[model samples]
Target chain A: MTNTILVLESVVLVLLTVLVAGLLRSHAEILRRLHALGAGLDPDAPTSELASMPVELRSRVSGSFATAADLDGAGLRDDALHVAVVGTRHRTLLAFLSSGCLTCQTFWTAFGEPARLDLPDDIRVVVVTKDASEESVSALRKLAPPNVSVVMSSTAWSDYSVPGSPYFALVDGGAGRVTGEGTGAHWDQVKNLLRQAADDASDDSREVRIDRELREHGIAPGDPSLYRTAEQIAQESRA
Target chain B: MTTTLAAHGLAIGLPTGWEGRIQRRAVSVAAEQTHAVVHLANFALPEERDDFGGGVTPLMRSADVFVVLFEYGPDAVGKPLFATQGIPRVTADMFGSKRLQRPLPGQLGCQRFFTAHGRPFCLYVVAGSRAYLPRILAEVNGVLTDLDVAP
Candidate 1:
């Protein structure tokens, strides 16, 4: 009888473990949904491990900015783009780059000719590099395009949690949040990523509008009208 | 929205549709002293420009405005023009054609000398048209309001 009881208790303990695992998964899903809805993210999340690698790109948070202050060896150039700026109304693409990285060469050239990259006319592109202490101002000035601004702020690298050299973050100015961020091997990949993120953001807004309209018409989510009945589906499929 | 750009012991917040740069020429000769030159403009700046803005000032449209903060040698620190002793606050009324270093038709310019952070500098402003002074100066003032100099 004692052995039987022990086996029963062991079975119950295994069941309990499975139950806890399920609950944990559900909680994770809930957190993921919350993040999708723009909730509970710390914009000031500390710099990540990726910035140290200087070869991959990852996403990060808010940062500081300073310009017109470090033109000592910059020659005739106006200012270096080693600034950390936040965009409010316009979509700003923060290219967290390093002066010493060879991977950044393509991006620098692409940004100099942003029009050829097929970016939207409204996007404001800026490059961010480490502060003067870690970079060569003259070299950066040489690589910097006459039209684009290269902000030099080490805090920007940390603010965005950039681990290494060439990473890109697309900050939605209207939403005031990073929509998508990752590293790309070249400008084409980076441009496509940005375009895709912009498209996704717009689609989300479209869905939200549709949802609002349905509610305004007294049709809540999961309403019968939102989904066709089996008979209607059959008829549509047949047609 | 404004972008605050701080470099070379100088800082300024550039307003929307405006850009600014601070540059210091290295002392190429022993007799020549180094000083910072800041250029702020509402329109697009060209690739080439002198310390006094000779190349770009001519491109200003009727509603455009150009500002230059040209730092002078330390010897001019105590001069009467530099006696104001701080970043000068610009008023629309302070600009006139007579103050232009090289005046051109339809453009009115003003110049102010001041010392900040023990450095003497000239604040020169040019408005494309006097009729647009109020609007032009308002934008210029908004940009300069964020001006700073660190020792």
Candidate 2:
């Protein structure tokens, strides 16, 4: 009886070990595939890192790249110019989306509706889709918002290094640089991101004004008076 | 900062606050290489615009700048109208409201026909405000410096 029990125990142990090994291999393979698809495991990583990321907002690497890719129309015969994202007088919002994504539907509907965006500011919005090869043109045509420009450019996807759908990039045409970019599942979440970008811009302008005033008062960088401790600042303020 | 937009061997550099695109229109699944159109502007461009800014120019605000680079058949190259060897350096005086495709108020338009890089092309520009013509033309010229011909 004892010998039989030992054999049975060994068999069970072996089976368990094999199962664990198989599971580990499967997990590793899944991660590898995700990585291959440009999906980043970390939220703090670059925009493309989290390709098709969850419906959450993440502040991206500010000024990650100096310029954005110019958008060329993919499968459309319309007279739309290959839209440029840089060097514009006003702001432009590039929405990277797909026709089939369930998460993207909310956005399409929101943008397609005749109602205003009620966005943080007045901005030109453009929808970009992968080449017709990867996306369904018929579905897109049905979903294409009358208010926004839809361009089917696979090159634009690779050029922008977009990892997944439902991504947003705000381009300051005057500066011709990406002021803000990230992924959002819905318009409400995306709207907050735009608001945050606007706040950051406002903050930057305020800082610039403060710095100019200080310089006008003859206080430059590394000035001793600027390095005063909190106590000194409090005392001066009190005075 | 400036970004370069190139396609079909034609390239142009866009300066800060200037956005534009290059395209060879596709009739079906296959893209057509003929009649490439390049549009550059210093204002927000609407998606519904025609090659000549049908939906966009009407929305231009004061001080906006729009440039259109319309490509023609290679046969159009070296014609008297396109006799210029390279993209002509646009001067301020070359612009006037009369040159506009439509007589829009407070706008000035300039058109130049030239050949560059073995291709025939027309360079069209519209100034949103006539008072800012010289300054806007200067900005347009700054960007045109990077214009490339075929290949």
Best by DockQ: 2
lDDT accuracy of residue A102 in candidate 1: 63
Residue-by-residue lDDT tens digits, candidate 2, A44-148? 654443344444444443446436766765534433335766655567788999988766877888897635578645587889999878888889989987668
Residues B1-151, model 1: lDDT tens digits: 3467666788787765566667777667898868777877766555567777788878778888888888888789788878997777777678777878777888888888888889888998888998898888777777767787887
Among these predictions, the greatest lDDT belongs to 2
What DockQ does each candidate score versus the true complex, computed on alpha carbons? 0.12, 0.22
Q: Write the per-residue lDDT of candidate 1 for residues A1-239, one digit (tens) a residue.
A: 99999999999999999999999999988855544322325545443333222323232222221121111122224453222233233566778777677657768778787668788865667777787778887788788887666667676677666767787777765455667677865676777677667677688789899999999999998888778888998898899
Task: Assess the local accuracy of residue B78 in candidate 1 as a C-alpha lDDT between 0 and 100.
Answer: 85
DockQ of 1: 0.12
Each model's TM-score, in the order given?
0.59, 0.63
Off by over 4 Å in 2: A1-55, A59-89, A129-142, A150-163, A169-185, A195-239, B26-34, B74-79
**Model 1 lDDT at residue A74:** 27
How big is the positional error of residue B46 in model 1, measured in Å on the Cα after superposition? 8.3
